[model samples]
Target: MGFTQADYEKFRILRVTHVAKRFDELIADESNDALLPEQLFLTAADDALAERAANRIERAVKAAGFPIPGASIAEVDYRDGRNLNPVAIGRIAATDWAMTVRNLLLISPTGGGKTYLACAIGMAACHNGHQVAYMRMDQLARRLTIARGDVIAHQKLLSDLAGVDLLIVDDFLTVAIDSEAASDLFSILADREHRAATIIASQTGPAQWAIDLPDKVAGDSIVNRIANNGRAIQIGGVDMRQVRSHEVADAL
Candidate 1:
């Protein structure tokens, strides 16, 4: 009635390594002798599913390209001066808004952890089985501009960006956008509108975005879609980079 060598070989052939490992452990442990056949099978199946889900999340997180890959919403600092609302953060972390195709705007001063917060939200989305993409506005503009040289590459890039479940744009509107880049950005945003979620992390709000872009109409349209469709989280705190530096120096 016990699993034979042939059974183990069959598990290996089916690539159910987690199930195979679990079965090996259960068989090697005398404490599991009293477990019913159904119980043992269910436990091994649970282990296999859990391992596969964890691996899928890991792969999605890696593909997200988060600058701060390890950031977690649960670890956010809630110090008195930070002005972070635990309730709002919890809502964001739940990722229901993202599933509904809503957007988020993270407004903070330089070094106020906007990127970290964005990454944390992205990590949450990934955990919820959503695909995520992170890109700095300047870098995205450059990529789109380069892709424009090739029609196929240009369309493919837009398609890829539009297809992601969540797209995080960091340092948004930090630099002046030329007409061509503005047009490309508008196209990407338009494609994603009402279909996918986007997170804009910026030191400045949407008010200044229009003035910074060469094309007035495209700039206005972009700002309207992002600002109007998204909820804003304003982070007020001392510069986190400086705070960390002081901590390191004190330790030294």
Candidate 2:
């Protein structure tokens, strides 16, 4: 009953009205609980702070532009047939690699869930308070093509891509990249090297990358940057999509 209006306003501004209300209720009726008013207020404040942190993480994840925004490591399948290593994933997650900007290279056959795994990693990075962005290689190339005419816009776009803590490039090597696109891609990777991390989900392996990229020089540059410091994960098994389709058929 003795709470100041100014204190209530401050709590509301911090988005901790629940804490404020709880304190008010405690002040009104301390007979219900034996704990001191200060102790109750501190506990409520801790809960409010945790809620705010979670809200911030959710907002960051939403802003990350993940193709599968809901992807999470908890949903990853480590069944017998899949070649994924749970230990490796654990090790990766335990490290500060995301903070150090180490790259992740996921190589798999078509429909092997490479994109999903990459997005899962991106989501984890988001949980760790890192910013992320997801884009398909062809789509990114197209965007670069459109931005080419305007030097300022092109640089700004490249800057934006490079600025994120993690950039997930999915469906890589889906098609042969032309010289211009290859150059732009290399520039983006170059700018990001040692400054930020990248996750590349490719159906094709690095060994075949040189053959797919038309500009051999630029292709080599980009591949070298990734290979030099990135950790590679070779995912092998039947396509999950096909398995899911069969399951649906059976259900039907």
Candidate 3:
């Protein structure tokens, strides 16, 4: 029997368009004529499943909001003096760190590729079917400050941040923050504690965070929650931005 328009419509209604398309393609292929019924059915099912999985990963990567969308772990440069360990990074990428709610702290100098590494790990999490969010510390502070003007929006924003599988905050403690922003940061970290993972990319370590935050107690709490519970990776190397520019100049 041949697949008809009715069959196509039914598959579309069921949201299995990939299956229908695969089945249609197989049916139109003369080479598939000798295949058994079970073989044909299984082939279509496999194709549909693979396509769906790919689509899901694509959606997750898009929703992650990575500044360097194309950044990937496999593409990382592990040159000397970077202080990056391939084995450690590979283990982190292969493990369920996000699912287990393990935080990560990336400390590096300006243009040291902290953002790229964070985004790469975030992409890995997304590939593992985890929801991820990326935002700079300043952006997060501004967001919280603006959201506070609307009560409902403020709560919703907090809830959303607290629920993600992984939250990557870049440029952490780069600038001093007000008491209100510090309070909001504490609240978010408190809510996410033991619930979700976080990645903090900062120029300096947690020791300096308290000085930059107006609320000492909240700052300490925030630092304790992140630093004590998470693993830290300190990157030391020449500024990658400069390296890349020099390479480009040489090429030109």
Q: Highest lDDT: which candidate?
A: 3
TM-score of 1: 0.91
- How would the candidate models be sorted by TM-score, starting from the highest? 3, 1, 2
Clashes of each: 0, 0, 0
Across 1-252, the per-residue lDDT of candidate 3 in tens digits comes to 667789878888998878878887888799999998678878999999988888899998998789998988998889998999999988777657556877899999999999999999889888888888999988999999999999999999999989898899999989877899888889999999998888999999888886777887998899998988899999986699999999999999
On residues 1-252, what C-alpha lDDT tens digit does candidate 1 reach at each position?
Answer: 456788878877998867877866776688999988678878988988998999999999999999888999998887776779988897888876445778899999998989988999899988998899999999999999899999999999999998898999999988876798888888888988898889999999888887887888888999988888889888996698888889899999
Predicted model with the maximum TM-score? 3
Against the true structure, candidate 3 reaches a TM-score of 0.94
Model 3: ten consecutive residues of lowest lDDT? 92-101
The alpha-carbon lDDT assigned to residue 169 of candidate 2 equals 90
Q: What number of backbone clashes does candidate 1 have, counting pairs of residues 3 or more apart or in separate chains? A: 0
Which residue runs of candidate 1 sit more than 4 Å off their true CA positions?
1-17
Q: Scored by CA lDDT, what does every candidate get?
A: 0.87, 0.82, 0.89
TM-score, per-candidate, Cα-based: 0.91, 0.87, 0.94
Error of 3 at 252 (Å): 2.9
State residue 117's C-alpha deviation in candidate 3, in Å. Answer: 0.3
